[model samples]
Target: MFWKSQRKYMIFLIKNKSEGEENLINGKMNVAIIGVGYWGKKIATEYSYLSKKDAQINLYAVCDVFDENLEFCKEKLEIPHQTKSLKEIFENDEIDAVHICTPSETHYEICKEALEHGKHVTVEKPMTLNSLEAIKLVDLAYQKKLVLSVGHIFRFDAAIEKAKSLLEQGWFGDVYWMKFTWTALMPPMVGRDIITDLAPHPFDILNFLTNDWPNKVTCVAKAHRKGQQEETAHITCEFPNNLLAHIEVSWLNPERKREVQIMGSERFTKIDCVTQKITGYENEKFFDMPNVRSNTIGDELSYFVNCVRQQTSNQVSVNKNNGLVGANVVKLLELTKKSMINQRTEPVQ
Candidate 1:
């Protein structure tokens, strides 16, 4: 039944692409959004807005299994093309790239298929549930000569960029340790736990600021809810130069907080991730740091589009949230789970 519907959809897309070949000749990149749910809708909106300003980009199509989502894209977003079949999107030679905002479990297969069809892909984080799957996607994208990016949106945050600059300039001299607090009170997701769902941001942020991966990790986690998957977790990571980092993620906390603090011999710096605000303390005095906040999702989508264009033109493109970075974060997630299971620190492989 599924294959029959997909075959019809593919034929429809082929006919449409034939009529639209002239548009592609102008070097305009046609992009699609798959899975227009909560987060995917936001990504689509950013692309829509970007397309209005950039003549090189076209917010060409959207795909979702739900009829209401497709309707929303057509009626609300004004996207021209809508389909429920992944095959149709992959087979459409007019689509140069796709933004995948589907569930984490589906990332591996969707990404693999997209790459196999010669389409550039940028997928939401935790690229895949397993490290091996993530690695395979990375290798496949490289072999296909396609741009594969992950939605590590926080790396584009204004506050985070400022923090990285300050650290690079030795503003926080001789950094000691860093702490990340990401907590909220929310109902448990169907098949997701705190580590996989929430820990990637902090882990990736740690790497963004320090430019280093953790050497060892120790984790303690528990489930206070109905499922066996942990809802709260505390991860301790050891990085180079004896730098220690801690990440606390929970779904049980009443107060929602997304924060990061860095302690050093010269000063203490704290970032409010949600507000994009930064504060610093030195000698018992506190001061505000300059932060010009920007929409991170907008920045991220723009960067991905630029990368796609560069790749299409055979130019060297620098992708900060590349596939390898996503794979490493997935590996850390696996090691974190392993540490929790063994009740011991595990060396990062």
Candidate 2:
């Protein structure tokens, strides 16, 4: 029994594990959401819906530059307050955290400003546009003692969650090779490259699914479509323990696809993170793994909000990277571009 439990009677009946008794009502935590665009709307909607199940959280505010979007969210959630400027949000001292789902280019500035406000922060993936800014944000969050979480939404997928648990349990034999494919008729770059906008999800998922940091990176890129940054590309990265991995990301596909295949000596696991389904093959037998029921995006946001309430446990395992992830992303892009440049000079093999 605990005071934190919804039943107030439990506080009086409960005994502390060591001290015998204590009561505390640390109460609800408030969350402020910035951005009301596609991704932001999804996260805010989930946070609002989850709050119904979780009484300890209040989705206190929503902010966006667009008045119509703000109004839509307010009407959708029945919340009375929505603001256009983030100044209105950060001005509220009661707000304890922020989630950013704006454009990739804006990630660094928004996240930096939120951190300086002493608010715990969660921003959509890629960390930032480049490694330098990403490093600064990671370092600053630690300095402020505010929880910093990157919305690596797939990290909350039950398939990867189960994979991590299986790895710990040694269910899969010695691991070997992993292949991931992410194909979509990706949005035109317009102002930013597809590489910058799309690669982070697959990159982060590969890392999460493998539970390893890359040691070396090499890549090949192709730009078949005009005015697009590498409409098709292949990235290969090496991890220690002789584990090899390959990733293919393309905007050229006529159909959307998201898949990961992990190969072990005894078992091979294939998952479609996009569809939230997984299949495994072992000993010449094909089997479907149990359902992966995580509302991953929702779960990720809720987890961040919950950690804000807990106030002690960390949210992201690799929270402080000094922009190593961004650096690696740059390394991959550079290597792929180098390959493309060299391809023009070399004769057919």
Highest TM-score model number: 1
Taking all chains together, each candidate's TM-score versus the true structure is: 0.91, 0.82
Q: Candidate 2: where is the Cα deviation over 4 Å? A: 1-26, 312-349
lDDT of 1 by residue, 45-114 (tens): 9899999999888999999999999999999989999999999999999998999999999999999999
- Highest lDDT model number: 1
lDDT of each: 0.87, 0.68
Instruction: Identify the runs in model 1 with alpha carbons over 4 angstroms from their true place.
Output: 1-26, 312-316
Candidate 2 lDDT? 0.68
Model 2 lDDT per residue over 1-349, tens place: 1011112322332331122111111687778788888888888888888778888877888888998888878889865578888777776778778888888778888888988877778877767766667656655664555666777677788877777667667677887877878788865656665566666766676666665456656666767766746677777767767888788888888778777788887788888776678888888988888874788877787667655555443222333222344434443444445555665321111
Give RMSD to native, each candidate: 8.7, 10.0
